[model samples]
Structures are given as structure tokens and as C-alpha cells.
Target: MPHKRAKRSIRDAETAKKGHNLAPQASTYDDTPRSASRIFNAHAVQSAFRKAGRITSEDTGERKPKPSSSTNTSSSSSSSKLKPQNGSSSSTTPTTKQTDPKKPAIPSILPNESLGEYNRRVEEFLRPGVSKAIKEAASIKAAEEAAFRREKKDRKKRTRIERLVKLGKMPQAALDELDKEMKNKAGKRKRGDEDEGSGSDDNDDDGDKTTTKPREREEKSFKPIEAPRRLNDIVQAPPSLPHLRKLGQEKKVGKGVYGAVGKGSGKDPLNAGQRRILEEERERVVKMYRDMKAAREEAKVEEKGAKVKVKV
Candidate 1:
């Protein structure tokens, strides 16, 4: 409760004459205490923490006590405040509710039991459950972490494969094999789910008819798949150097080959399709050069024939 100051009273109320001048000054402020400071017990502290979810009841080994005589008095005062005259309920006595038999009653603190003994008893009552919960939580977290790492690795590998494919490094056969593996895995998962469903149904029926024996479960073997060889490995290409020129610098033509344009690492080879396209482009360039040479020779021959005609 907050401390409230006493209200000031009129200084000369009794001696005041009609129309007499009243004292302009009021009384000084009073500093008297209103309510005593609250005292906290360990049990009350534990109960507060429990209610606030900061600690479990088993951790403190204390149970909340039922409302005492003080609460009853407070209830009576509240009932008086909400009287029938104030349009409240007319019942004078509070009703007693029946306890459910299915619900377990809280273990009461023994009169002779110390706090330490109560804590020990609580620990004894809760140890098994707490340990089991801890183990399950730890195992679940470990499995989740392992799964996350595996997924991260797989994602990195997939991205690497995609990057190589874009750079014309991976072979067509490798891509085909990867697609086939994915399809087979999907099919296997669907079949496995169906099999498990049927097996569970059969087990349930057999259990109903007779006692079922515990079956030893076989561990599934996990084999790591080997990554396919890069196309460059099959068709060796000349080692290309990286571009060493800085930005904004003019590229010198007819000087030296700077680097291969749009090509990734020199070690990574081009796919068969790219190689074929390069071969076709080379053949076309050669054919165009030969035609130009033949045309230049014919022009020279026509100039000579005109010179001979003029001489005759």
C-alpha cells in the first residue's frame, strides 16, 4: 500500500467569527508512516517464482497453501462492500467446492519438516522425470543439429554442381545420372511409406489375436554417392590464365591473349556441345577466308586481261 499524508484541517475553525479574516497559511506536511513494509518468506518467494514460471514447483519442493483466515476476512470485507443494497448477491457465506477424485492433491509440508528436507523429498519425487526430459531434449537437439549440417552440405554441393553446369564444365551423362537418382529416391520413399503402413496394420491385427513378440529392427546402411567427373577431365583443354588488368584500362588488341572470355577455371573443361560449336565456328571462319582469297585472285586476273587487250 502507498503511504498517504494526513489531510489538513482549518486552524481557527472554532474561534472564527462571521466575516473574520481567515489564516492564509495551511498546516505543515506530515511524514507519519501509513503501512508497515512487507516481509518476504522463502516459501512466499518460491511460490512467487513458481507462479511467474521462473521456477518449477518440483525445483523448490513447495506447494501453494490454500487461502487462510486472512483471505477469508478479506473476502468478507469485499462481500460487505458489494452488499445487497448495492445490487450485489445476497449470500453471506462463501460456498465450498468439491474436489475432483481424479486430480491428485498437493503434498502438504510436514510440521516437523525443514526446508532442506522438503527440497530433498521434492528432488526424490521429480528426479526420474526430470532426467528423462533432459535426455530426450538433448537427443532431439543433437539430431536437429546433425540434420541441419547434412542439409547445409547437400545444399552447397548442389550449388557447386549448378555453378559448374552454367560454366559448361559438367557433362551431359552426369546430369542425366543425377536426374535418374532423384527420381529413384522419390519412388523409394513412396514405396517405403506404403510398406510401413501395411506392416503396421498387420502388426496391429496380429497383436489383437495373440501376444506380439518384440522384433529386432535392422539398421539401414547409408552409402555415400561419388560425384561425377567434370567434362574437362575427359576432354583436355589448354590451360587458360586469369585476367590481370585493372578496371578502366583499355584492352590492347593484336598484342597478347589476355584471357579466355566468360570461362571459369582453366582446369574445368568445356562440355561436348561447346566443343562442337567451337569446331563449327572455326570451319566457317576458314571457309570465309578461302572465298575472300579466291575473289581477290579473280580481280587480279581480270586487270591483266584488260592490260593485254590495250597492248593488242
Candidate 2:
């Protein structure tokens, strides 16, 4: 609705008012307007073209210094400094030195490197330490396995000693000695014996010999285990009760006087149910005797196997 110049003046007034509230300018601030240069230079477009390699012509979109007779000597000296000593026409750009062709290409971190390059170098440096740590862990695992085996063997030995002591075959002193040895070695046995006991064994031989004499006496003093007495082979005869025998005999006859009321002054005769219960009880006693006999046979076999003949 407003005229162009009136609108422009109004906008300018508003901007000037807003500018007063702005933060302080940066140190790189430039007062000159860039409107003309932005259109004519077109730096963004030139950079894009350069990156795409589309700027094929000699025109680099940059202004080159003009050659003048007054600066000829300075330009010649600068150009001379840029040239190689070999006097080749090629530009003296730096090239990385070639390495051995046969060697594998190893990634390395150079000055100002980042990302994959830095990571590669760090990994290479840590490789040996990582491998060594893995090997050490494996060795520790092996040591643990060996220690577990030794502990299992020691447990079996302890159990055997305990059994012998319970059976009166071994004295309590041997068990106490084993316990003492276990306590002494508890802390130092994890990494396995390192030949420290070899010298101690030689030095303590006399003491060991003296101790062995008492152990031998204890072994000799132990009484032999006497075999348990065999059960009495005499079979006792059944009771001579007339009423029970009569009832049992009557049971053999089918439809006999089993459930009928008895006509006697003495205790009433056992009924069919009572006779049946008595028969079951008798059978149970016979089964128990058979089981006992089998158990005795098994014990005899075990005792034969357990007998050890000392070659004196």
C-alpha cells in the first residue's frame, strides 16, 4: 500500500532500531558492503566447480598478477627458488617416499591424522600386550585346573584316612598330621610347589626318621579286626499249642469247621480270619530269615575281598 521509497525508509528505520539491541561485533568485522563483489566473484560457484573438476579451462576464476618489467627480477628469483636443482621443467611438488614393494602395507598415524589411521596405529601398538594378556589368562586357567585336580586327590586321601580311622585300622595321629600339613600349605599351595620342600626334606630326614619309629609302633600295635560270629544255625520248632495246630489242620480241608462257633470251655478257637493272619505272619518270618541269610553271604564275599596278605 505504501510507495517504494516510503517502504524502504520505513524498513531502514526499523532495522536501525533493532541494531541497537544486537551483541558487540566480532574482531573480524568488515564495514565495506559485499553486494557487488558477491555477484561478480561468485566464490561459492567457483569452489563448487573446482571440486567437481568441471573448470577445465585455464581460467581459474581467480585474478592473476600481471607481469611488469619493474617486478621481473623478483618474479624470476621466486620462480628459481621453486624449481628443482635438476633443472626439470616439471613442478617441484613433494612426493611421499616409496617403501619396499614386497613388504605388506601397514597403516600408520602421521602428523594431523585422525579416524581409521589413528585407530590402526593404536591397535598395532596394543596387539602384543593383548596377546600376552590372553596367554597369561590361559596359563592361569591351566594352573587352576591343576590345583583342582590336586584338591580332588587330597580329598580322596582324607576320606580314605577317615574311613580307616573309623574302622580302627589307622590311628588318630595320622589324621592329625595330615591336617597339620594341609594347614601349613594352604596359603602357598595355589601356585604349586616350586621345589622349596626338596631341601627341607633332606634337612628334616633325621626328624622324619625319629617320627617314623613311633608311626611304625602304632601300626604294629593295631589289633586285627575279628570277623563277626555267624548266626545260630539251630531252627526252633513251632509251639505245641493244640488249638492252633487243630485250626491249621482244619484250614487244609475245604468247607471245614473254620467259621463255625466253637463248643469248648477253653479260649474260643481262632476263626478263619485269625488263622489267615497267623499264616501271613509265619510267612513273613520265613522271608526275613532268607533275607538275613543272603546278607550274610554278601558279607562273607566282601570280607574275602578285603583280606590283605602282608608279604613279611
Candidate 3:
């Protein structure tokens, strides 16, 4: 319990006995009534955390223990205090009313044993397994909750991806590209592991040689996509100079070119849709170019009219 409420409180005097009430509160007459603290529902708090037992007033230290002696307190000067004094030197025989023993309200529901004795016996019986069960239950619940959170997080990510796809922010090609990149990375990692195990320095030296090669350098290299300066540089440049020929591709052997060969076409070799997709993409580019040209012409005409108006 928190130190604040552990001390005897006003509720102890007020609720201790049926015939009792708290002694007349002693305070400065100038004291205005303080706003009462908001009362919270204990059960609600308990349920929020999925606690097994209901929270009682005792749990919050709000309710003090009921007096063990089930008798009325005598009117005395010490009684004016908030709590009854403990370990008093003067002991008096507490007065009791002569009455017949009351029958048990629960009938056969309660065990035919005293509370202290029965509790001790039952605890001795179940003590061996109860603690282990409680710990296991807590661990299992934590694991389940952790799994549920992971599942929820993944579901949220999937939903976000789906929304992006619907909004056209994420293309299907982007997903495929990511999958291909992941596969490539996995393959590269596996190859690296194999290289480490086999003690292969030859491939490493070859990579270093390739990087050092002057022809592969970019500064003086030509790009195939770039328009030729003289329009016929494609055939004018010597085949021996790879940079001047086609930027990169050089058919030194086989049916495939060198640049395309290194890249593995990276595309699906068995794909039948590549031709269809390329045709559709070409058509889309042409249409887009026409629309852009029309827009530029329209904007130029508008600008000319605005300038003519300003001159006038």
C-alpha cells in the first residue's frame, strides 16, 4: 500500500461499526470545503488490465480492516481519535450481548472448518502447483499477446500497401522489382558464403581487374541512348573502341552482346508477355509525346497573346 493511505483514515471510524459514525471533524472554521476526489470504479480498472480478481476498496487502502472484536466501542476521550489505539496497557473486559449463535447464511457452501486452519491446509495442498501454473499462464499470455501484435502490424502493412496500389502510388511492377531484388540479394549472399568457404580470391581479382579496366570508365564513354553528334557516329566509330560504338554492348561472341550478357537480360527468359508489353509501352510513349507537344503549343500561343495585350 502507498504510505499516504496506510495510516488510519476517516473512513475507518465512519464504517467500522453499524452504530458508529466519525467523530466531529476538527479543523479550522475558516476552512472551506475541499472538492472531493473523484471516485473511480475499482472493477473497471481491474478489468482493463485483465486481472483475474476484482479490485476491492482494500486494494486501494481506502477501506481499513474491520475491528476483529464484533462489539460496540465504549464512549471515551481516546475514542475522539481517528483510529483506536493499539497495545493499550489498560485492558478492560469488552461488554457483549448474550445472544444465540447465528446459523451459517451459506449453509453447505462453506467448508466445515475455521478460516485460518482451512486456509493453511488448502494452501499446503495446492502450493506445489499453483505458483508454477500462474507463472506459465503469465508467460503464455505474454507470448500470445506478442504474436497478436506482430500479426496486427503485418496486417496493417498489407492494408497500407493495398491502399497505395489502389491509389496508383504503388505499381505492380514495383512489387515484382522488390521481389526480384530480394531474390538477387539472397543469391549474392549465398555465393559470398560459398566464396568464403572455398577460399576463392580469383573472382575478387577479376572484379578488381574489371574495375581498373580503362574502357569501362565513364567520363569518355558514349551512351547509346544519346543522339550522335554527327548523326552517323553509330557506324562511324571503330568497333574496337567499345565506348564510341554503342556505349556498352559489343557482340564479341555467341548470339548475345557483351553488355546484355552481363545483365542476364535480368528479365524472365520464358516470358511471352514481353513483346506485348513492349508494344503497348511504345504506343503509350507516342501518345504521351503527342499530348505534351499539343500542351506546349497551346501554352506558347497563350503567352504570345498575353505579351501582345501588354504591348497594346
Candidate 4:
């Protein structure tokens, strides 16, 4: 609606007289009879048409200015543009911040950048610091883990030493000496095991030298193992076929035989159900006999009335 008041056209016009370049300035103000109305100027139209025709015919937008008359006119017009006295918004050109043209260490975000582009920029800028922090954290965690493992190993060694001391297998002073042994490069190295081994060898040599009597020679008691003479004689003899024994041969009965165990008529025929009934009847008969014995015991106790006569 606001732009409706403004009208621009390059339709009909004749450049009969000396013409100038047409450049219309847009006006913005509170609405008024003159400000809201559209105006048509014949001279302005003619100027715009001549300018367009000149541009198309010349074919080059970057036209070189004629020096003599236009030089002074352009200088005066450009210099006449007043700088903003206060905070005026009437200037056509936007103010640009002054910055160095050389690229910076970290690339800056663009005005119309997409999300993925922004993420990439952030990663490029912060990559060094983030990676360094992660490496430092990992190193610290590894150091802590290594220290924990070392502490556990030391605790196990101490427990073994303590147990040996309590059991009297190792002396208390030995345990103390072991604990006090220098572990660092600046101190003495331990050779206690080598010393103990040498000492035990020396004691064994001394015992051997101080023996009461020379080790007695015992009579030989071992007998050599020998195969039977008959086995040797038989092996040395010529090979011959072994005699067959009738009793050792397996017997094969005809059809309907009870495997190799019987002729299939040695035992009585019985089914699974009949065997189960017989077992049940056996259990019932045993229970009945036990009941009768208990009743006889009760009757004898009643008749005797807790008194029994012992014959002299």
C-alpha cells in the first residue's frame, strides 16, 4: 500500500533537447496529499528513455566520463554529500566495519551459513583444545589405574610374608629385612636368595666332611627280570596252528532260542502287570504278619500285667 503511491515507467518520451541521466530518489514521509500522490513528468520520462537507449547502444556499462565539463560537476556533487551530523537514517549507503583483509587463525562464521557448516566451523576452531583435553584425561586415568594395580600387588606380597612369619616358616627379622630392602636405583640391590643357597651348600659340605663313618656299602638285593624259558623256546620254535577246544566254542540253537543264555523253555512266562500285582500282595502279606505279631505282644503284656516270673 505504501509503495502504491510510487510509480515508475519508461514507456513514451522524446529526447528533443539536451537530456540528463534519470535517477529518481525514493521519498518516505508521513502521508500527505502531495506525498501520497503519483506524479508523471515528461522531461523525466524523456531523460530515462535517452539513458536506456544510450546504455544499450554503447553496450558497455562501464562508460568513461568526458573530462572537461563533467569532471568538475561530479567532484562537486560527491563532495556535497553531507556526513551524518547526528543519528540520521537518511544515508543510502550502509556503514561497514573496518577489518583486516588477511585471514584470521580461526575462521569466522558466515552470515547465511547452514547448520552443518556452522558445526564444521566450530570443530575446526575447537579441535585442538578438545583433543588435548581428552588425551590428558586418558593419561590421568591410566596413571590412576596403574597405581591401583601396583598397590594390590604390594598388598598380596605383604600378606604372603605375614603368613609365613606367623607359621614360623620364615623368621620375623627376615620379613623385616625383606621389607626394608632398598627398591630404588639409588640404593643397594638385594641378593638374599643367592646368599641363602650358598650357605646351605656350605653346611651340606661340612656335614659330609664330619661324617662318623664312611657310608656303608650295602649288598646287592635287586634281581633282573627275565621271561620264562618255555616262552623263549616256543617263540624260537616253528610256527604251528593252535588246537581247537570243543567246550570253548559258542553254541548256536535254531529258531525261538532265548539268546545265548537258554533254549527259550528254561524259565516260566510272566508279564509286567502280573509281577507288579505279586509285589503288592507280598507287601500286604508282610504288613498283616507284622500286625499279628504286634497284637500278640499287646495280649501277652496285658495278661502278664507288667510282671514276669523268672524260673530259679
Better of 3 and 4 by TM-score: 4
- Least well predicted 10-residue stretch by lDDT in candidate 3: 103-112
Report the C-alpha displacement of residue 203, candidate 2, in angstroms. 30
Candidate 2, TM-score vs. the true structure? 0.26
RMSD of 3: 34.9
| lDDT digits (tens) for residues 164-219 of candidate 3 | 88899998776666557656866886698678756667666677667664676567
lDDT scores of the candidates, listed in order: 0.67, 0.70, 0.62, 0.64
Q: Show model 1 residue runs off by greater than 4 Å.
A: 1-106, 176-312
lDDT of 4 by residue, 1-312 (tens): 665543333212233242557677677774656533434455686688788864332443232222334457767575454332333343223333225655234455566888799779778877888898999899879968976786678678878989999998988987776566525311332255467668999888898788667799999988888866664343567779897769877655554545534545455456789999999999999999999999999999876874555421
Best by lDDT: 2
- What is the C-alpha lDDT profile of model 2 across 1-312, one tens digit per residue? 445355778879989988867787677866557987677678887898889976432554332233435567779566533222343333233233336775434445566877787788768866887899999899889989987898898899999999999999999999999988887777666334545557567667777566554444543567889999879857689758655454445443333465343443333677789999999999999999999999999999877777743322
Q: Quickly count the clashes in candidate 2.
A: 0
**Candidate 1, 1-312: lDDT as tens digits:** 147643344435534533467668766874544332123255686678778878554665544333335467767566443222222232232332226675433344566889898778767766787899999899879968976786577567767777788889996666667667766866886699699889999988788789857899999999988998787756468779996999998765432243443343243356889999999999999999999999999999999999999999
Task: Give the runs in model 2 whose Cα sits over 4 Å from its true position.
Answer: 1-117, 187-312
Alpha carbon lDDT of residue 267, candidate 1?
Answer: 37
Positional deviation of 110 in candidate 3, in angstroms?
A: 20
